[model samples]
Target: MPSYTYPVAAPNRTLTTEEIHILLTNTRVLARRLADLTQMRFVADYLLSGRFDATGGGIFYETGEEIFAADAPEAVAPGSEYPKTVLTAGELASARTVKWGIETDITDEKIAQQGQVVVDRALARLANTVIRHVDATAWGVIASKVTSTEASAAWTTPGAALEAIVRVQEERAALGTGLDLSTVVLAPAQYAKVLAMLVDADALPRNDSNPVLDGTLPLRAFGLEWVTSPHVTGTDPWLIDRAQLGGMADQTLGSPGYVSASGVGIETLSNRHKDDKYEVRARRVTVPVVTEPMAGVRITGTGL
Candidate 1:
């Protein structure tokens, strides 16, 4: 709603060992905050549905008429029988803001002296970049796929999944949406040979020690974040390693393909009763944290 920003900490000039400790304590909290904000952005932008090959845009929880859990009065206006409820829409308009309550310690003098300012700043930057990359990928996929905007879920064969990936690339090209799609979410088996193929094509890094493919390719780096549901079962779960998260953020996916008819329809549907059809909209929301990875740990000599 407000361009999605991370909470800012007030600046203080005082520097003490105890204050420094507090800053370090809050650093972890800020990292979690970054995660929370980025996760929200991911869900809002990337929820997928419909047939895998013929998938569509995702549906999000939006506001509309509300039926009270408890009922009392029926009508507030004269001659009105229908339940009166607040109708609303959009993430900014209806979604709850996620807050991470993080507080700093008062006794850490060194952290306070350093201000812990650098760490917080770095966390913010990282969060923004990760959220942006994820949003771009989600939109790229949606724009290229063939399906309905209201598509709830998707199921597809291996072949269709491959085709969908190709179509995604093409769609991006036509729409001037710049993205290189290399990694695709598919039934584990479907990706096995493809993984090998990627390796053979020199697209994937050569590594046998790490069972998980080095999805982080120079031309097409990949990092997988999975949602485990009862529907997705009996699968080899190893995809992307969380350790690789930092690297994947910078890599690009290789050339992709797309077809005009491949994606779901974007439309304005009229609700006759309401007498208006609202357009489904989209945007990439990012939350960023900027912090230094390593803070110098120096032992200061205080007269013992």
Candidate 2:
């Protein structure tokens, strides 16, 4: 029988202050890259500073108020008419912290092999988790707004999706709010489907030199800024009047404190096991709210 000898364990090596700084710096760079991947910054207006007060009030315009025309009379009527406005008080319903972290045992072998790469990957993952949470929260708020429907069939044609969006715009117009529908956000599959339709119909002007086709500019279709987000799944796409959608964040901590266009906070904690293990963490706090539900519409049943 052959006897097998156990491999010796590697010794633990303490990281120097300079090495620690480099790890943190690299981690921050990775976090920023992950933050750039988030989609909320393109669709929702964000307020980075202000405490979320549950007692805060919201203003709502009463719908269907009639406008009367005055006849040219010898005597001017002293009566004044004004649209009814209601102050609906409500608190910010969503306020929470999201966090992601990782712990790794520091081994001499790992240090020799540039173990900081592990921390860099962890920080990148954490940043992505935090940013995605913020985006999901924003989408949740937007989804809660008014919803409209299209024909219960898959949009197989290019202009078909545009028609669905136009219906939402028409609804806003019918409300007489004079809000311009400026933004359309859809799932990636839907966007690709619509783009193909446009291409097939020859409706989209094409130029090999065009920045939009070359990916230098954003894709704009039918006078609406087109945005694709994975957060929007299934058959529901959103049409929004930018003026009516607003969001704010408390700045008491800092500009976007926990969450921002840049990235979230990353911290390192020394473990009690004689530096045998250490923890790396990322965290963010944010609350996204829809200020005017009437200004946006969710289109469902696209069958995409």
Candidate 3:
């Protein structure tokens, strides 16, 4: 019973002013690095995906008319002049880029107790917000410009899910513009239901068995790459012709107009708030437009 008293644990100490400055600087750098990568199950970038740079805050697009030939190529006689063709150019249109942003504050006391780990977590939340905002905004444009809607059998129906897509493909083919619907964005609930049906029907086979799919980042079936998002507000899945859907314009990083995967621009700013806290401001400057509304279609009646 004569054991020595246990040593008291060292108490945590508050970080110094200089230490806080260093922390803020590191966080800013982290934000810059995060900017290079942004693509994450976001349907906006995949659907309205003609990513390009804006010269003067506005993107000029052609609402091109889908011109179709009235007849097959006529066999031209050796000396006869080629048949004259008259064309009406598509009307010119423009969409302006609107800046979208979100921000948060990190208090000195919180960081003093929690360290930079908390700061990193907060930065992550900021990035997520920016990306999600881009998607939501893009979806808003799509919903507003939908050209057509088709009723679909619920995915639970063994053969109906695949058939619905085929029907849609047929409709697009009828447009005579070669609108190839290569991607589909599903509501989370519909996505889950489809995956279950695929497994039950042995379309998504087990690894041990002869795999029908490669188990890749983009889950594919029904002749299109499928993705799920919480932002896809309804049960209907959206089918899009990526090549002709529309375009998303963003502010250029430098002299070049190329934007990265996220179709977003992320900027992180930090400054000490009179020695009490640091504020981080993150933003994306971009706009989405359904320049070719007919290039996409929404499949409805998924639950039915």
Q: What is the lDDT of candidate 1?
A: 0.29
Q: Give the TM-score of candidate 2.
A: 0.60
Residue 67 error, candidate 3, Å: 3.5
Q: For every model shown, what is its TM-score relative to the native structure?
A: 0.23, 0.60, 0.78
Q: Which tens-of-lDDT digit does each residue in 1-304 have in candidate 2?
A: 0111112122266446457544444544434534433323322232111124322232222322232222322443468554445444444444433233344444444445675555445545555565565666667756755454444345767667767677767766786677677777777788777667677787775874222365422366578766665676565666776655555342223422132335233333323234544444455443555655556666667776
* For model 2, the run of ten residues with the poorest summed lDDT: 1-10
- In the range 1-304, model 1's lDDT, one tens digit per residue, is 1122223344445435544344333433333433432322332122332111111222123222132333455645777577755544323211111111122222223224444554344334444444445544433332232221111112233343234434444553464323233333333453455455545555443563223443221123233222221122233221211121111111111212211110111111111122221111111222111111111011111110
Q: Give the alpha-carbon lDDT of every model.
A: 0.29, 0.50, 0.67
- Per residue, candidate 3 scores C-alpha lDDT tens digits across 1-304 of 0111112222265446557558576644445434433324345766776876776788887775656754446779999988766565567888888877677888878887877556656766777788798888888888777758988866666588778888889877886768887777787788777777777787753662222344343565555677766787777888888768787787754422212323234666676688688876666788887767778788888772
Each candidate: RMSD = 23.9, 11.7, 10.4
Q: Name the weakest run of 10 consecutive residues (lDDT summed) in model 3.
A: 1-10
Question: Which residue pairs in candidate 3 collide?
Answer: none
From the highest lDDT down, the ranking of the candidates is: 3, 2, 1
